[model samples]
Target: MSAYLQAKVVRSRGLCVLSSIGKSVLNRDLWLVTVGDATVPYYPDPESPSTAYPKPKFAYIGGMHGDEIGNVQLLLQFLEEVCTAPREARLQALVDSTVLYIVPCMNPDGYVQLTRLNANYKDLNRNAYSSAFPYARPTTRDATIRNGYGTPLHPEAAWFLTAGGAAMEPETVAVTSWLAAVRPTVSADLHGGALVASYALDACDSKGSINDCPSVEAPLPNLLANAYSMNHKGMRVQLDDTYGDGDFVNGTTEGASWYTALGTLQDWAHHVQHLHMITLEVHSDKQPFGRQLAVLYSLNRDSLLRLAEMAHLGLKARVVDAVSRAPLLAHVELLEPKGMWPPEVEADGLIWKVAVPNMRYSGTLTPVDPGNPDARYPPISFNFTLAASWDEVVSGTGLQGLSAVYTMRARQARRK
Candidate 1:
């Protein structure tokens, strides 16, 4: 099989602007294809006018596992369609406000051999961390894996043993570094072989999942839950009929058969960078490649458009101060632990009244020390509060103090 993509992958002519984000382990050009205009700010800037380009961003990753060919095709199709579609449409309007960053394939070396492991036989997903540099040398069993190419010593094990956690492959290092820089509000990593949306949170082996993390105070996750349902309308039908898990569902019940790998892209994406994330498994039963690819493309089209729209709509807010009885710059965070979606934070540019969506969130406004605005230590107290949405419209005060405890609504959604 040729290392290059043999499929007829043709994206829309004007939709995607492809650029190299970094180089892979073997020095192949790693592309960071963006599907929106570049004039927008990456994060929300309140100082700018209402016409200010909104900084809401959503990231989509595909083919972190090189062998997941379906994801590669799906993402490519999405890039073309979303970029070329009319901006006045709901999907294009969302894309206009939201910035999308996609890494179509993370493991170029592994894809070359049609193998799960990368060039040095490193499993890209398993090997993710700031440390763990210098690709790990495969052990004796690695040679055995290479030999048993045609036959499966159990397909699950074949895929499982391909990589491990904590070791950072070059691609992962580049991707993670970029994630830190972009700090997107919402992100998703595309995977295959399972036809469901998996919101795997911090706990490895998918145990002790929080229905919602209190830190995400807003109704952000709830909005996403509804959005996910809306995007996949009429297709969530399964024998069990249980489509969404609300938040985290323990691994034991949901066929938790895989090994627990730490420092995963999703974990770091949420834990470290504070972005809401989902591991979208597209299709099941290891169906026909062409059929699976089509399913992936179908799912990607709706999901991507929905996410971009949500980011654009969700980022709308105003900041104010508590003591001055005036508009102030404060930090607002929206977190969802169950879905592993990162927190969304906005500072300043709030006016007398702000209309927040029904979604739950831990909202706060902090007094910025003119001396050191970024000072994270010993944060100042005194923020604003409005009991109800109507109250928020009239109140002009900043936050009175720091939150007694950071609260979010991810767990709340799971409970209901």
Candidate 2:
């Protein structure tokens, strides 16, 4: 573990360190540091006063590739700045309004060895669950015996493909389990070797070629990518002549459009977890320290805070009982204009529906059985129709700071 990371863990007010499933090959502790509203429970306890509401959750993950030192360093720097600068009003407001989970280094073993893969010689980026390589087997163990000369097979790949008995890699299980538990509204996995914000659908279809599959959560990533690129000076300009048109328009690209890969974290988060996640390729170099680190942090400071605020960019509300005034664990269904899919419902009764800044959509709040034995209320089915124009929900101009918490009341279920 880096001394800097340890120091941050000590000094940061809301720091929670979670140990990865297994120690690194060198036996170093792989830590996931979460900062912000530490008291917020992962799930609402029915026995306790329900604090669950439509607050946005955001995740920032880095160091999936061991050699991507810049990715990890940038996240650490962000954490330090936010923790140390308590008087910074913007950051404090963000913390107050949203829950931020950060996994600073997902591949500590690879980082220690200065390799892209872990000690098992598997690329963690390719270890996630994806539709393209659903049944892919682990070749790392086999490759080791073949003098390390074969296709890489991550432990996660093996576990998913195996019929009945296999375990996921320690790091993979750690991050995946955490994400599934928290279920952030938006997340970004940092990377190096490129300078563009990459959006989801990182893998091709079952046929194995790149397809222009657009995500239903496209607007959120688009807004996030633009915020990062536009805020950073010179990021929008293309200095590298080798890439397309020498410049990334506002520094963003679709993942599969850039290159097809199977089992990437961003795709897994979007497809499996139903979260809006993106891969942020911060810089072209794998490692940049000291002065370079300062420059990187300075450039991305505002963008980082802005992205956190993006969670409030949509319509948010809580579903409650009509007479009892108790929170009801319910499903929010968005009936958008033709051809758009509805957003996923949260585990809590909180509903957050992402709409374009000025678009119109109809939403329905349907109360269903929460299925938890400790739940405050029993499952009842009733629909409350809702219609809203973005203009009504948004408080002001520019979608960044808009937030509304409407308390929707459901009618009692009539006996048939």
Candidate 3:
């Protein structure tokens, strides 16, 4: 796998990057292939979410369930396709606007054993913890809010989240730690064993609705699920052979609504990382076979690209001190959210959240470090009209009449 990724780096003339995020349970390298820019790409370090990324960082991760090999194969194929695509191709444009981070397999131990659980018999999918369930205190994420997350909804939930939290597997630790550094704007956790796109990972709603989306930020997450389902050839039309995972409204379901998942990577990305994450179950069988695999790849081709495209459509801005002009860590939230805002994104003042295109979204920015200790600094409120395309952000085409001085570039207002 390392050889293939490294070879692609050479093939693409420095457009591709191959790096190991961390080691797996069996000490196998958890490799990540970054597809973008001819200039050697800058990898983000922890606590550095700066304008180093003028474009959105998007990731497609697969193989949480070692048995779900199709997801792994599909992502590998995607990397090949994009790397070989012509410089002027649509794939290049998509790459131009978004930094594509593709991790072909997250659980090599499970994959080698052809099992759902890792070598330790723990399900990697059930090993992620969300920091913002009962929600979190915006001022400091010194600790995860544990009000309602300590209990197990089912026996499977105990694999990770419970009264006695299990130790995180190496693969789980590798993923969580890597995410902190990359700080992707969007992510798709690809899976098999079913055929549908699911989002809003909370297992239940605030009003006790089972498997419903339980975030104040449901609209954008739902849009992510819809983008995959609507784009797939039969995700919305064909029902899965066994699990009945498909043929839903628009081929998308609220995750945990279709079925409950505890400590999944998607939920952690959404709640803890303040990212718009969705799970894509692209096949009916856990292990796909035969020529149908090619057909399946064809099914998700457009959705894969469109998902990255959506990242560019949302709220893209940066928060900085008016005096020192330094980036200020801030929590960006919708103005009239139905519930508490998702956890604060640890970025270098730059924030990009999925939003409805052509619609007006009122939002607020609460700085983590107010410049003046003597004076009171209240959350600054602002509004903007989202564009239908990513051109606004990619070209640094200037602002959308923003009230706050948020230049959507690495140096923020340098383009101004």
Candidate 4:
């Protein structure tokens, strides 16, 4: 770890000390870095009328295959910015509530070689699904369309597969294991040389839902993906394809299939540990550095902000519960409300006031099950009992707390 991530060699941006996981086959120490609060209380209050919210966790893994360089730079840049930036309201809020873990380089030996496969020539992503103890690395690239070349014997693969899955490569095992312990809410493995934000959920497969794993929940997989797309849709500075909006597929193949590579990082984090894992392909092989950097910043800015906002809002219910006499960790979804106001009166300085809707339109509430890792909270139907109106909060024993607020422009006000 020291040899590869020497402090002197790395530019001082978001420079956190790297912990030694172990050594590579080529005799290099594997390393990892953890950022944000580790210990925090997380529980739902049943008596409360809303959901209990805790800080969200985000993990960014880069340089896994070695040749994917853009993501490594992006992680470095993010680390620097996060470290130097003052603990303003947003930053502190995210830190206090959310955990951000970044693995800048996964396969250091392979990274030095600048090859898609690690030093052992094994494609790390392919052989990650074995369940047996001290998993074996696949010696063959016959799995997916020969995406890349390499055997499991590659020192990097052997370290993780033969050693204990991710543990085979000391750095990868340490980081992956730590993630399992922390159970981050979201994580993404950064990849390059691809243009789409490929989501490998089990879609159109005869092998019985291969994409449905313990890590990614049903609605959330789509919800988070859509949110990312929506955030980047209109940004003027963003490039055409940098935001990762594209069709969804189970894997990089035409058919869906079940996989069980015991030591795979993404699958381990999601299935074994239950974190929302997304593989983000950051740049194409032909993309230039400057343009790639622009794309990275755009993604970091919007995606991180959205994650923070959702985490913050999720915390709101718990905060409300603390103040109220009754527990408020009930099923509640806050929707932005919209309403039409009567003609506004301009008096003293001719400033106009538009009436805004205090309550949000009612939507279904899903009851969360704490014990079930793969289970999605069932949506509570509310439309049958009440008309969809802008004024009422629309609460029930079934729906608990569903509220929203909407702000309309003054120019759109109607006449009495």
Candidate 5:
């Protein structure tokens, strides 16, 4: 796989760049393949206009479960397509408009062993810290999960308060850290064992049976799920009428309604980072074999690309301190908690939110500085009317007419 990735770099003519997010439990390299123009800085300088290549970013992660081998292959093919596609193609526009981050193998140890858990025998999905569950963020980190089930005893906790939480695995740390750095506005976590796109707002019965929960944040998980399912001919239909959780509404299910999962990547990405991530169960009963790879690619190619484009369909804003003009990590939201999609500005001071087109949405941006309270900024409110089509306009910032990026200056002083 490493050689294939390197070959792509050579064949891509600077289109594909490879780097390591971190190591696996057994010290295997967690390879991160970035497919886009490498010359542009991820976050362009606000003061300098020419270098401001601000656009939405889309991320795809596969191979969370070791036995789900096809997940990794699917993303590999997607990367290859991106590298080989014509410069004038829609894929090129995706690359030009947004920075793409792909991590084909989030669990190399599991893939090598062909097991669902990592070398340490842990589910990487369950290893992440979730905002949905109110477990304390551990002060002193360790690799031991307090609850072997990877769930909370209380079952319903708000955000973590105390400095005591479960220990985490290395794979979880690596993926979470990488996700924080990338800060994808829209992403998809590929999986196997089923054939439907799953959104969030979850719950599992006592018998561990999954249900059909709807999104509190409507059109978020739903829109992306529909985007993927409607594009994939195979995803929208069910060969077996009675599947695990029965037929999803057009091949889409709410995360909670599917089952009660603890510390899920889907919940963590949305609740904590405001990233619109969906769990795509790519295959039917089990993982498909070599012969089915091409079919899987064919079914998912357009669906996945649609997700990349969806990243740019909503509001995009970059907020900074009004005084120093330096970037500030502020919390930006477009709706209430149910329809809510609030993304905190990355180090780049940018938030590209995914949303339904042609709607009027308003939200508030509150700057945070837990480390230094004096540096905190007041909340700033915004109102916007989205275009009927792919209307993501960048208002203000002396950059009207061009609806790609917006700069918001928060009136506050940086603590000396």
Candidate 6:
């Protein structure tokens, strides 16, 4: 890992470091490589004084399930490609506009032992706070012996469950801290066991029935999943009805509808962090080597690039006080296209609304008044119903890009 980082990442001007890992784990250094130019300033956040512009941030995580070696290798290869192939125009534009964080392996102990559990025998994927069945006291044999149970007793389990009062594992702590600090706009968690891209709502009711609950941030995930599957040679074409009568169309599933995966990383990222995240189950084989590696990379290279480019997709703008012109942490909501909701305003008073390409949306923004010491704005919220027709939002060029600074004004007082 160090050799690869020095040779490819460091030399290529990408930032690479051992973000965090377990002390007792064999390979304790979990590598975090970031590729992008922050100076470009794609979109600035007003609330965060540290950064002038909060560039669209995207995260690609792999090897959470340690035995899924292919997951890790794919990301490593992607990172190297991004670093070494700087001359690629499309890739360069993406790096300039967005910040990419790649975590090759999240569970080194599991990778070393070729097991799904970490050194503490905890399934890191099922240990997050968003997990429906978080690690508690043991009841079943799988929980106690195989470490399949969701119990916070394990140090590793505790770490990932930091949001839920679990002990912080060094590895989990590193990722949580980084995410909190960076606050990525989108993320993809890579895993294995199937060849499909799955989206959030991984867990269901207590009865364990599939949730099938649609996600508000569905457009971005659907766009990403389609990109990944369509780019792959055979992924889009379903060969067999393995997942109940052609369940996955175009290589994407709604997660819980396919299977109940409580406490998954993607769910935690979406619900808790309010980030558009998906789980990419890349290969049928957990470990692909030699020719298979090249073939896999070829299948998804363009798709990866396209996914990164999606950072600029949808609607983005800054919501500020109309009088003071100062950034305001506003509440932005989408009333139209019922299932999708807008992400909360960033520290810089910026809000991003992810929507389908051709669809119209009705959005509302309520900015907090700066002069008001109580932090309360007049009840006059700004409501905008844009794109009454597909042509309005999608021009001849397609998906008309919207980037502007919206100066919100408080309701004017009526004169007597």
lDDT tens digits, residues 1-416, model 4? 35435452244343344565555557665555555544453323354323423434566777777787777777766665555446456555555545566777777787788776766666666434434322233432222222255433233333333334332444455556567565555566777775333333422212122333421233334344433434443322223433223223322211112322334465555444444565555556623387768776666555544533332211122212122222212243423232211111111111111111232233433433333334333444321111222212111111112212111111111333
304: Cα error in model 3, Å: 0.9
Lowest lDDT 10-mer window, candidate 6?
390-399
User: Judged by lDDT relative to the true structure, which candidate is superior, 2 or 3?
Assistant: 3
lDDT of each: 0.47, 0.63, 0.66, 0.43, 0.68, 0.62
TM-score of every model?
0.62, 0.77, 0.75, 0.54, 0.74, 0.76
- How do the residues 394-415 of candidate 6 rate in per-residue lDDT, one tens digit apiece? 2222112422223444432344
Model 4 residue 190 distance off true place after TM-score fit, in angstroms = 0.8
Q: Could you give the candidate ranking by TM-score, starting with the highest? A: 2, 6, 3, 5, 1, 4
> For residues 1-416, what per-residue lDDT tens digits would candidate 2 score against the true structure?
56776677677754434345345556666666665664554322233235356457888888889998997888888888766645476676676657777778888888877888877776777767544344343343432332255533332334323321234466776788878888887788888887777777765553224445667665655666665666666565634434333235567766666665556788778777777777888878888888998888887776666666666655566666677666666754565644445645666566665556555656555665454334343343322223434333322223333543355565566644
Which regions in candidate 5 have their CA more than 4 angstroms from the true location? Answer: 38-53, 85-88, 129-166, 203-216, 239-246, 318-343, 346-351, 363-381, 389-416
- lDDT per residue as tens, model 1, 55-83: 45677787777676676677766665665
Off by over 4 Å in 2: 14-27, 38-54, 131-168, 206-208, 239-247, 337-341, 368-400, 413-416
The C-alpha stretches of model 6 lying farther than 4 A from their native spots are 14-27, 43-53, 131-170, 239-246, 320-328, 337-340, 368-416
For candidate 3, give the lDDT of residue 346.
Answer: 46
- Find the 10 residues in a row with the least total lDDT in model 5: 391-400
Give the TM-score comparing model 4 with the true structure, all chains together.
0.54
Please name the candidate that would achieve the greatest lDDT relative to the true structure: 5
lDDT of 5 by residue, 13-95 (tens): 88788999989878988888887764465443345453343566778999998988888988998888887746546677668
Predicted candidate 3 versus true structure: per-residue lDDT over 1-416, tens digit per residue: 77877887778776678889989878888888888752433323223344343566788889988899998888877887888747546676677656889899998888888998877777777676555654321211212333376642243333334321455788889988988788777788888877778887645522222455555676667777776777777886744334324235677777766665666777777767767788988887788767877887898877787776665556556655565555566666766443535323443455655565555667676665545443334677767666454223322222232111234211223322
